[model samples]
Target: MTVPSPSAQPNSLRRRLMLLAVGCTMLAMPGAFAQEVAAPATVLPANGDEIQQFCTNIADAARDQRYLLQKKDLEKLQAEVDARIAKLEERRAEYEDWLKRRNDFLKQAELGLVDIYKTMKADAAAGQLELVNPAIAAAIVMKLPPRQSSLILSEMSSDKAAVLTNIISSASDSTTSKEPS
Candidate 1:
């Protein structure tokens, strides 16, 4: 098969026929032969009003996004603070409960020690108490009735009794000072 050369003749019948075929094909599928036309010249705002409006819209959108992000951050921080506060409140409540239990235990022990001293012989109790803390011995003696306290004091050496008496006096003064005015 031999390929035909392009016709140089201006009015060649074959060239006219080829041109007609191409025109028909281009018309059949307009999109395939479509040219990119320049967009219609936009009428811009001469007074800068439209430009300012567009800038304002962009700024408003940016500000809204920033505000939303900040709101989310603040909410997270608030939730964290609330969680910390809840934990602190729980710890405080636990500490208060433990303190109440400790105070109750100490009071019961003080009463039990007072009872033991009341039941014991004065001389032996005095001797035993001398071996114990002076504060504890004084507290126990103070809980006793006047006659019992006098008997226990009499059994104790004068110096020891004097020491116990000073402790009791100071303890009483401390307690009095702590009372609401």
Candidate 2:
């Protein structure tokens, strides 16, 4: 005959457990019911050595996971820095091209302007320069030949001449070009 499974039994596990509890209560003396049942003793493992061992076993894995997360963060930051540097490099290249075009235009214009002033009479040139921007007048005077420049300065008012002289002198001064320490 084939044996039946525990679930096929006539009494279930809960029913059997309840019947056992009732039988034990009936067997006890009536005086025992009057006395309170003492609580079961509680047992605790000392110093938690098992918990410490479990933590120690997983320590290396936890540390590796932390390091992996930090590495990903650093890599992300590095990529951002690289992208910013690339943008700055592009801007610098554009700036250099613009500066070169500006300088080329200035050189061509400066040569033509100086030639026009040089051909003029010294008194007339000085009178025209007096009405121009002081910086432009000083630049033209600086570029002219020493004898021509002297003649033009002599024709100018003493105050205007002194100012031009100071500008020209300072423009050539090496100390002014040096960066402060």
- Evaluated with lDDT, which candidate comes out highest? 2
When summed lDDT is taken over every stretch of 10 residues in candidate 2, the lowest stretch is 38-47
lDDT, candidate 2, at 80: 100
lDDT of 2: 0.69
For residue 1, model 2's alpha carbon misses the true position, in angstroms, by 99
lDDT of 2 by residue, 1-181 (tens): 9988755863554345444443444343244466665442233223354346435545665676678889999999999999999977876676666556545534543866788888999999999989977767887887788899999999999999999898777656534422242
Off by over 4 Å in 1: 1-41, 110-113, 118-181
Which ranges of candidate 2 are over 4 A from the true structure? 1-111, 177-181
| Candidate 1 residue lDDT tens string, 1-181 | 9755544443454445444444444444336457553332244333345446445535644666678889999999999999999977876676666556545534643767888788988899888878877767777787787788889899989989998898667655523332243
Clashing residue pairs for model 1: none
Give me candidate 2's TM-score against the actual structure: 0.40
